[model samples]
Target: MRLLPVGTTLFVVLTLGACSPSAPEVPVGADGRTDPVLVQGRDLYQANCVQCHGSGGGGGRGPQLNGGTVAASYPDTAAQIELVTNGKGAMPAFGGRLEPAEIEAVVRYTREVLAENG
Candidate 1:
């Protein structure tokens, strides 16, 4: 006879489900920037963040972002913007490549995506 624990099965199922590729955030707010920001953020993240941060915003070669890393490292959104714009240790600055608006959009996307996953 085979015995399967309930909790173990549930954990296995959840782990499998979470392993799938993350879809972009849809059904954004009325403002194009708000929701579209997440969609655009997904693109920006795929292009930039994925190299370091995991596709799901989890830690990779760098550090985990879904936690308070940004909030702790940067005082506020502006600080995060500054870091992303200016770059930090090992991380390259993206200011020239992306416009301020695009940066904000990607920031919003990161936060939203983190929230959804967390």
Candidate 2:
């Protein structure tokens, strides 16, 4: 095979690096549970809630969802679903934007993952 020019080789390397797939954004939490549903929920949260809720549900524009905050406020999952689906106060309604399954996934993520960790 013919040798590539130095610049061409460098360009190829850089292009390949850029095209490389990124690591999974959802990491297995300290709990060591890697259930597919929870992972999916984490992914959903990152995509939809991270902007306002902060990374790991630490809170930012939206109230902190970690620890017992959400649990204490909305003990019932249905209530949590309502709050998320309809939105309240500063939180915008997600009912229109996300599917019912997506909403359920996020709720489970917040309750099971974030709350457990907190």
Candidate 3:
């Protein structure tokens, strides 16, 4: 019979324990969009962003985002995606915490919800 070394068994167990499942992401469609994403994004932003950006994305601890100020300069989605994935100034990198799908949805939500008003 084969047996794993004690160290190997411990390492395997620890790794599995450390890597827990994150909150499930709202699924997007083939067209690559969904209102559910917005809802999820809203929930995420409320939990994660409201303290800094304010409930409406107005400037608080963070700068105002509801004015479409951030999204306008991005020539494409990639640029915006990069900024979010990587930490910039006060913004912490959410790369490990938020799945790529959630990030994309948040970006879309920012455009859809934050662009229209103050």
The number of the candidate with the highest lDDT is 2
Which regions of candidate 2 deviate over 4 angstroms? 1-33
Error of 3 at 12 (Å): 55
How many residue pairs collide in each prediction? Answer: 0, 0, 0
Q: Which digits, one per residue and each the tens of the lDDT, describe model 2 over residues 1-118?
A: 9999999999999999977532134456678857777777888897788788876677889998987789999989999999899999989899999999889988888887787553
Tell me the spans in candidate 1 whose CA falls farther than 4 Å from its real position.
Answer: 1-34
Error of 2 at 23 (Å): 13
Candidate 1 differs from the real structure by a C-alpha RMSD in angstroms, to one decimal, of 6.6
- Give me the displacement of residue 106 in model 3, in angstroms: 1.2
Error of 2 at 5 (Å): 21
Q: Candidates' lDDT values, in order?
A: 0.73, 0.81, 0.73
- Misplaced by over 4 Å in model 3 are 1-34
A best-first ranking of the candidates according to their lDDT comes to 2, 1, 3
Worst 10 residues of 1 by lDDT: 23-32
Tens digit of per-residue lDDT, candidate 3, span 17-114: 86752222344557887678787787777666767777667758877777787677775878877878886899878798899988887777666676
TM-score of each: 0.67, 0.70, 0.66
